[model samples]
Structures are given as C-alpha cells and as structure tokens.
Target: MDTSIFTDKTIVPEDQDLIRELKETSVLWYAIRNHVHGLYPDAMDEWHYSGVKYGWSFRIKDKKRVIVYLLPREGFFKTAFVFGQKATDVVMESTIAPSIKELLKSAKVYAEGRGIRIDILDSSLVDDVKQLIEVKLKN
Candidate 1:
C-alpha cells in the first residue's frame, strides 16, 4: 500500500489538505518549511509524484541542489536528505542522536550521496532535520 497520505495522482495536495490530514503535525511541517525559507531565501519547493509506491512528496531545493524531500503521511511527515561523505561524517560526529547517526551510517551510498529518510512524528526531530539541512548546505 502507498504510505503517503496524498496518493491520488490526479489530486495535488493543498495547504488545507495537509493541515487537515496531518493535524497537529502540520504545525511542524509549516515550521520546517518556514525555517528553511527563512534561512535560504532562494530555496524553491515543488511537489512530485514518484509513481504509486512512493506517492506524492514535496522537495525543497537550493537552486539546483536538493535540500530535502518532505513526504506527507497521515499524522506526520518524513524528511529525506542526501548527504555527501563530508556531511555524513559531520552528522556522525555531531550530537544529533544515536539512532539518526545509525540511519545515516547504514544508508546505501548512491552516486549522489547517502540518502536517509527521517520520520518526524513530533517536534523532537525537527531541530535535527534543520541541522541536517545546514550540513547539506555547507557541504
């Protein structure tokens, strides 16, 4: 089954749809989006439908470089990032949480970078995601 809340290819999710589907977690969603935009004025975001398996996702990018992919779920969202060797090493060494570090370590290294998807169930993981975005921008 498709994990994303917005699975219908014909229907693109609007702000109200996300707010309704995500409920309280929608606050976190807006927080992160605003945080990214605040930090990087030129950052651009777009929605993409990656077939049936993955469904719809919102991608935030800095010009040509992708910063993160926000996947909307029923009550929460997942942030995906691709970190290069330097950024991965930085995250591994930082004080971001053991579980997240492990996720990065175990993620398969592709031509772009090591991709990891972090589920944002609550506000606890929001800062971590923002820090990771900074790492992505710096390295």
Candidate 2:
C-alpha cells in the first residue's frame, strides 16, 4: 500500500451509474446484505463510522455487504473495495476473509497516500483472516 493515493481531497463515488450494473451483475449482492447483520452488528445503523483514520470511514449495506472506500486515494481514485456475499459459516470464512483483505489493501494505499499509517488499537482478530491479495502496478 503506497501512502500517496489519499493526496486528493475530492473523492466522489466510483460510478453511480455502474452501481446498478454492478448490483445486476453481482447476483449475490442481496444475499450478502441479508447475511451481513451478524458480521457487523452496528453497520446497518451507521455506514461511515469513524475508526482509526478519522478522515475516512466505512459504509455497510444490509449486513453482509461493505463498501469501505472507493478509489486508490490517488489519481482521481484508482480502485475500490466491494465485498460480495457469504452462505454458510464455512463459506463466510472462505469468502469474507478475502474481501476484507482486499478492503484493507485499498485502505492501506489510501492511508499511505495521505502520509499516514494504520494503527490498530485493538486488533486481536486481524490475524485470523485468510485471503490471497493481488496488486497490479502500471509500468
């Protein structure tokens, strides 16, 4: 995660029009919402809840879905982190873990761009996640 993506102060939604398309393309979106409640108890009540950054926040829809941040924090927003849905506990363990990893990768880039590092006050569970992360850089 490069700390140079969050230099811009003007970040808009990735693609409002594409949102409908994404929802339509991703059929499991609804299921994710239905199952997310147990994952994030207070997410539905508030989406952009403050955590470490204070400058940025997270947005959760339904219970199973999370739209943490959009853009790479640089170059007018480069990427986004959107989680899909989970079925059973085993599936959740398999899927959600990767989603979180992706989200964190995006966040890391955002934070690095802002010249800040992520400090977890209580990160007792970060190690439990199991997900393969991928990042592509332009030449």
Best by TM-score: 1
Best by lDDT: 1
State model 2's lDDT. Answer: 0.30
Tens-place lDDT per residue, model 1, 5-86, is 8888999899999999998999999888988898898999899998888789999999788898899998889999999899
Q: What TM-score fits each model?
A: 0.95, 0.25
Q: Candidate 2 — which residues are off by over 4 angstroms?
A: 1-26, 45-58, 61-79, 82-108, 112-139
Q: Rate the local accuracy (lDDT) of all candidates.
A: 0.90, 0.30
Please give the lDDT score at residue 30 for candidate 2.
30
Candidate 1 wrong stretches, greater than 4 Å: none
Position 31, candidate 1: lDDT: 88
Q: lDDT value for candidate 1?
A: 0.90
Q: Write down the TM-score for model 1.
A: 0.95
